[model samples]
Each structure stands twice: as structure tokens, then as C-alpha cells.
Target chain A: MSGGKPLSRFHQPIEVPGRRLLHHIHLNFVKKKVVGGGGRSMNQEIPLIPFIDFLLCIVLFLLASFSASGELPIDKNVKLPNAMNAIEMMEAPIVAVTATQILVDGIPAGSTRAIIDSNTKQKIEELSEILKNKRELWKQLKPNEPFPGNVILQVDRKVPALVVKSVFQTAAFAGYPAVSFMVGRLAKE
Target chain B: MAGIDTGGGHGGKRSSNHEIPLIPFIDFLLCLVMFLLVTAVWSHMARIEADAKVPGPPREDEQDKIEPEKELHVHAKERKFQLVWKEGSTVVEESEVERVSVNVGDDVTFPELAKKIGKQWTDHGSHRAAADKKFDRAILHTDNNTEFGVVIAVLDAVYTPQREFLVGNKTEEVPAFHVTFAAK
Candidate 1:
């Protein structure tokens, strides 16, 4: 108790060492509080649930909202026709008919007039040959299954009905009975 | 607490609560968002089924069964439509002709023709006419000079009549007929 006596005016000279010792004790208490209790109790980990939520949102958007139809190349030359009531086109062989030329999946088969003139009676010869070749290739891949005779016909909005009808006939003659006209959605009237 | 504790027990000690390195993680998230946004396709392409009217040899029994078949011919002229009703391979007189011109707000308007035809079909109690009925199939005849958009508009009008039913909060469209195309 005498060693622990309070410092007074008379003890001021001896109190310098005591003050330094007291400073160390305060720092130790602070260090313990910082490292042991309140600081550790305050968890610093980034809340993983929000990051997980963001990841799940992105995954759901990618999986659920993605279009079922794969990308179909749009020809710059052919302005696709518009329709009020239309459904999404399925993936199939494409027959693109512009004003001047006809393309089978981006490859020029023949001139529009040539195909029409070659078979004035309905069956377009060149297009039918191209489609027939395609059908054969498809059949080779799936020998056990029947060929799904479907074609995606993309025609320019300015093209005449005659050319479109001829293409339709050619598709039918080529063993592809179903022709789906690829069209853009018409704006609301 | 006083004299001896300072030099005996305390020295330079470092803290252990190091901050998490988050810059790379944030960068990863930003890149992923950009990649998904850039590759996303928003617009949808649609299809309208087109079938060729192939002329084939008619069987004797098939001809006998179809001798009484009725047909409706829709001739799409410039700015007008001529509706001709056919009965059993015979073209009848008294055809109903209607005109479809561009409205004030639209570039091409042909739904009026569809509305008129729908009215006629409904008046005749043939709105739900079967596929075997002549009204169920419409032959759309158009010229080469006519715009394909106009033809499609007319086709839309014929195939999908404006009559709709409300199901819950959504309105449902009632489709009418299958259309065949003829070029002049």
C-alpha cells in the first residue's frame, strides 16, 4: 500500500517514470480491446449472400430468358417482310429471295428470273436441287429418323408475290413441304 | 500499473485485422455484366406459314367428293379488294368489292377489308366455319406491283380476325382462316 501511494506535489520528480509506465498499461488495454473484443466481434467479411444473389440473378437471366431459336443471319440486301400476327421462326435451311437474286443459305443459287423461267409450271429447278442436296446431307446424318421438311424463307418486303410463290413451290417440290416465311414484327397501328 | 510494466511487457506489436482485397473481384463482376449485355439479343423474328398450291391429278372419287366445294377469291388490286364468291367450280356474280387505302396515321391500312369480311362471315353465322367450308380458305391474288407488306397486312387481316376474348388480364385473338396466295 505504501508502494502504491498517490503522487503529490512532493512526488512530482519521481512521477515521470510512473507516468511512462502508466502510458504502456493504457496502450496494452487498448490493444487488447482492439484485437480481442469489439474489433473481432465486428465481422469484416463481405456479406457473401449479396454476391451469391447477384450471381444467381445473372445465371437465371442467361438460362431462362435466352431465345430458343439460334441466330439466323439477316441479309442486308433482303428487307424482311412485316406481319401483324407472326410466331418465332424455327431453325432450318434458309432461302433468301431479294429483288434480283435468290440465295440458299447465303449462297447464290441462281437469278430469280432464271429459277422462275426454268420451271414455269411451279417447281423451281435450281432451288429444288439445292434443297434436295441439303435434304440428302441431313438424311445422311440422321439415317434412322425421317427428315423434317421445313425451310425458312426470307423475302424482301418489296419483292413480288410471284417470286415468293415460286420459292414456295420450289420448297415443296424439294421434299420440304413446310415453308415458314421469316418476317419482322409490324409496329402497332 | 506504475513503474515496471512499461519496459518489461510492451514492445512494437502489429495489428491483425487486414482489409480484404476487393478490387479484382469488383473488376470481374463489371466485366461479366458487360459481356452479357453486349451479347444479348433483344429483337425476335417471327414466321408465317406459306404453302404452295400444287396442281395434281384428281382421283375420280376425290373429284366426286369435291364437286360441291365452295371457294372465296380475294383479288388485291391497287388500293382496293374485289371479293368474289365461288360455288362448286362456278364464279358467281354480285361480288362484294371493298377498297383499302392508306389511313392518315398509317402507311398502309388493310384491316378494314378484314373487318368487313369478318362482319359478313359473322352475319352469315359462319365465323366458326369448318376447314371444309369455302369461307375457311381464302385465295389472295396480288399483282407484282403490289407491296409484299400490303399482301401480308391483308393476309393478317384474313387469317386473324379482330374479334378478341378477354382471359384474365390478357386479351386473346381469334384466328379465322388459312390463306392461299395467287400471283398475277
Candidate 2:
């Protein structure tokens, strides 16, 4: 500890008479003169306090955001519709209807084109099978509690209403009646 | 130089005084900030509630029951939207209906459809009052080729409160409609 007075309680970089030693470590490309006080630096203090405050503000904003659920898995091909009146994301079985495919809980159940083309006036068999199993499992888990017939439908913007109707009917036919459309939230309410 | 200068003549070796590693702490904070920023965007996913009443097989005890509230439906077509008013869920036949023709390409026309919807609801408000019901519920009937963006736009428009009414000394904003995305 063979030193004079501490240059700063928050340490300041030590510099020479004409140049800063820390900065000169990189090869000086241009020969330029620097005006430096004896052993003191004329360099402005980096505004770290304000920078930290800004970061804190951003952190606070993100923390206080309406996403108690950290992140939802958004389908790659599906473009969600933007709505101002949508509520917070609800926890339920997601039936994602893309351009070509119909997915129940991220698992491919069937093709959208097939459902639209086939003239069968029936609920989607594959989707119904999976949902029925899920319903039974939920019932087994909580026998006393009644089934909360809620399912979320996340459909792509381009997909026609025909496919959406089919998916909706299939979900309801499987005993999940209370449906919620999963939409992307717009800027303001 | 990277580590903290602890046991030295820089300050007296007071047990309470310890040097905190600011560089590593700053590194951790940078990591946290990056993580929070990345995760924040996915939270934009929200939901619109709609009741899809697909009547199941009836039990022996329940037989004849008619729902009193009318299910007003807005049918979306390629170039026009048809508003169908029904007296009850049991009432299969459409009573009074109106149409608003709009080009599918023009997004502005969709909001106009919502305005028509609001006006229709206001006109029926008196009839609803006679029945002692606040019939703000509406159903959206969309067929094949109707864009989901257009559906959401119409639904959002309907969800917004259009009128503020003075009730007992306070101005209360009455919401336009609780929209149900009807699929049959």
C-alpha cells in the first residue's frame, strides 16, 4: 500500500503527463497530442449512475408487464390477429390452426385442407381423440371439480373461417365448450 | 488488479469493510437485462373469451327449457356483413336483419360495420329494456375465406364502449358487446 492519497474514492484511471497509459496500450494510428494535468485526468466521469437508472427503469417496466406467464410458444407459420380488447393470456389447451396444419397442444392432429375438402359433417376425429383423453385425464386428476370447458384457439390471419369453424366444433364436440380466441395484443386498449 | 484490494494499508483492516466486485456484478446485471428484454416480447399474446354452447345429451330430469336472451349474429361474407337478430336460442328463424356491403381489401370499411353494429344495438336497447335485459351480447359468424385480422378488428370494435350513460349521478360507459365467435 505504498501510495499517496487515493485519486478518488471511486478509483480514477492513472494517466501520464501527456497521455493516458490505459488508452495508449492500443497502437496509436494517428499521432495526436492529448492535454493532461500532471497525474490527474481531465477525462469526464462516465455517467454510469444514470445509465444504471435507465436500465433499472427498463427492468421495472418489463417486470411489471402483464405477462405473469413468462413466454408463450407462438406458431411460426401462424400470424395472430391484433386486437385492443383482448385480456391476459389464459392457461388452457391451445388449438393452433395454421395455413396447412391443425395442431392440438403443439402436436399435429390433421391437415386444414383435408378438413375443408372432406364432405363429412362430423367433428375432427384426431383432435377429438386427443381432447377426450385430455378431458378424462383432467377428470381423473380432480374428480370433485367440474370440468372447466375452456380451450384457446390460436388461428393464423390467412386461414379461412371454414377451417376455424371446424376446429371450434371439434373442440366443443370433445366437451370443451367455453372457447377463447388467442390473439396478439395491439398497442393500447 | 482484477480482484479486490482487501487486506492492505489502503484502509484499516476493519472486519466490517469489504470490497464488492463491481465488474462481475455489472456483468451479471448486463446478462439479466438481456434476458428480460428477450422474454418481454412474447408476453403480447392475449385471449378473447367466447362461449360455444354445443348442447350435449340431456339427462332424464331436464326436458323443456328455452333460453330467453336473444343471440344476435353478425355473418361475415367476402364482400358483405349480414346482421341477423334472433328472438331466442330456440328461435331458429331470423327475425330482423340488416346488411353492410364492404370490399374485403378495404380495412376501413370493417370499422364502419362495427358502427352499424353499435347503432343496431342502441336501437334494440329500448326493446331490451322492455324485456328487462341489457342485451349487449353479439355473435360473429364467419365462413370460409374471411380473414382472422378482419374478425379481430370487428370484435375489438364491438368490445370498445361506445356510449356513456348517466345512471343515478355517475356516468357509466356501457361496453358495446361481449362477442362470441360462433361456429356451427
Candidate 3:
């Protein structure tokens, strides 16, 4: 404020007679030599601490926000129920049950009405066939090892137990006996 | 890391040959930061594994195996949890069924249930003497009319320990029972 001129007020465009507006800017900014009289280039050295701090903050924020585990492709139609003691989910074959239909790996295996209306024995034969094929493929992939009968069930929170049970029975009959229910984590009070 | 390359090295040495552009460097960092920020979502999905074994015909060898002091059963109704178990019969066929009911939202009921089941395993004279520390597996049956949330709540109650104990430098909570669901 002491060395510089006061800011000019703009009412309308007025031509100045003797003084120029942009003449002082080049003199203030452009310089031929970086070294000062004391042989220390104070203006040339950029303080990198602030920049480092900013970079560190961004890195930490990205790290904290990043989910290390691979996420299961979430089906927008199926809203999972919340559970208190739920554990981290792993990659597996998924069986999603929406309000209207049943899906195997995102493919429509059968209708929810068909499973709920029909008797337990007639519950979705198509789902069992798909599951059996998946099990066979998994077995072939790992010949010496025993098959881990893990199946992930992503059912809508509003879906009834009847539909869930039908899916389970079909999966079990198809050789995937272990069923894991996918749920949202309920916060502790 | 972005830096302003000054042609002047240290100690006031002057050179005009070196000048690094910072605009493109900052542009790349901003792009990376924006990409990461946009993709970041706090996912809360977790899993609870259950063995949905289909009940088959009775095997001939099962008749000889004597039942432990008690066998656990959890009957999940629409709005209540009915826990039934047998006390004194050597074989499951002769055991008496003792039933207890707790409403869905009772906070202490699940802890109390865990305590009851844990005591049943510990108080039994023979079960304590066995080499394996694990208790007998329990069967969970949810009625067709019940919602899946209630069943999950029951599973959480069964799996999570009632109390956490500070042992040495770490805290530990022992599981009460290994549970399986009744087939559809």
C-alpha cells in the first residue's frame, strides 16, 4: 500500500492524458537477473512446503476414500438389508433377487412370481441348471482342490423370505450349498 | 511434485537456459485428483455366510450317536424370536423342548440368549470334557411369513459376542454357536 498507487474507481471509460495503466506492470514483473544485491536469489526460490502439504493432503484423502477390496457390481434394483456383525464380502458368483425377478450373474434366471406361486419342488429349474454349469466350470478351473460352495445372494430388503428360500434351495440343489447374504453395514450406537 | 525451475542454481548463480512449465504439471495432478475424488464411494456392503443344507432322509448311523446335554433351535417368527432347546435327554428323540420368546427390538434379549446358550454348553458335564472347544451347531428356522431383515438380525445376534474381554494386549470375544438354517 505504501509503494503502490491507490486503486482507481471506474465510473465510465475515461482517457487519461499523461499516465498509462499497464506501463508499470512490466517493470514490476520482468527482471533480467534472478540474484539480488546480497547474492541470495530470494524471489527465484519457490517455497515448496505448501505445495508438498497440499499434495500430501490429496494423497491421504484419496487413500482414505479408496476401497481396497474389489466391489461387487451393485444392482440398483436390489437394496440389501442392514446387519450389525457383517463381514467384508469377497468375489463370488452372485444370485440377485429383485422384487420382480431373480437374476444369476445379472442374467434373468426366473420370475419372482413363478418361484413364489409354484410349489417348492418346481422352484426355478433354470437357476439350478445355471448354477450347476457354473459349479462345473469352477471345478474344472481347480481340479485338485475341493470346490468351495460359496454363493452370494443379493436380495432386495423388501423381498420376502419365501423368494430368498426358493433361491437358496435351488442353489443348494445345484451343488452350491453355502449361501452368503450380502448386507449393508449398520452403524453401532 | 511441482516446482518452479529457476535458471539460477543455488548461491545466486545465474543461468537463463532452464525453465520448466508448471501449468501442464498442475493440470495432470488436478486431473488425477478429480478422477480419484469422483470414483470414491464409501461402500457398506458386507456378507454373512450360512450353510443352507437340504434336509435329506435320516441315516442309519445317526441313531447311535447320543445327543449332548442340549441342542439349540432358533425359530424366527414375524415379530418374535422363539428359542427352543432340550435339557436332559441323552438322545435327541427323548429330549424335552424348552421354549423362550423375545421381541424383535429387545436389546438385552440377544445378549441374554447368548449367555443362556453359552451356559448350556459350559454347564454340561460331558461337553466341557471334550477336546474340541466348539459347541454343537444350532439350526435356525425362519417362518415363510417373516422378513429377511429379522432373520439377519437373529443371525447377527447369534454370531456377535455378548461381551468383549481384554486379554493381554488385545480384546477377544468368543463365538457362542455355529448355526445352520433349516432348508426351504
Give the CAPRI class of candidate 3. Answer: acceptable
- Per-model TM values vs. the true structure: 0.68, 0.65, 0.66
lDDT of 2 by residue, B63-99 (tens): 5875566656777666566777676645433432233
Q: Which of the numbered candidates is closest to the native, going by highest lDDT? A: 2
lDDT of 1 at A102: 85
Pairs clashing within candidate 1? none
Candidate 3, Cα interface RMSD: 3.2
> Candidate 2 chain B — worst ten consecutive residues by lDDT sum?
B125-134
Q: What is the interface RMSD of each candidate, in Å?
A: 4.7, 4.1, 3.2
Q: Which stretches of candidate 2 lie over 4 Å from their true place?
A: A1-70, A119-121, A142-144, A186-189, B1-17, B56-64, B77-79, B89-109, B126-136, B142-176, B180-184
The TM-score of candidate 3 is: 0.66
Q: Could you give candidate 3's per-residue lDDT for residues A1-189 as a string of tens digits?
A: 233334466544544444344444454433322323234455555655577568668967896778655456778898777776677887789999898888899888989876566635355788988999998999999999988888999988677777888888788878887789998776644
Report the number of clashing residue pairs per model.
0, 0, 0
Runs in model 1 deviating more than 4 A are A1-46, A64-70, A113-123, A143-146, A187-189, B1-30, B55-68, B91-94, B103-107, B123-135, B162-174
All candidates: TM-score of chain A? 0.67, 0.62, 0.68
When summed lDDT is taken over every stretch of 10 residues in candidate 3 chain A, the lowest stretch is A29-38
Candidate 3 pairs with clashing backbones: none
Query: Candidate 2's interface RMSD, please?
Result: 4.1
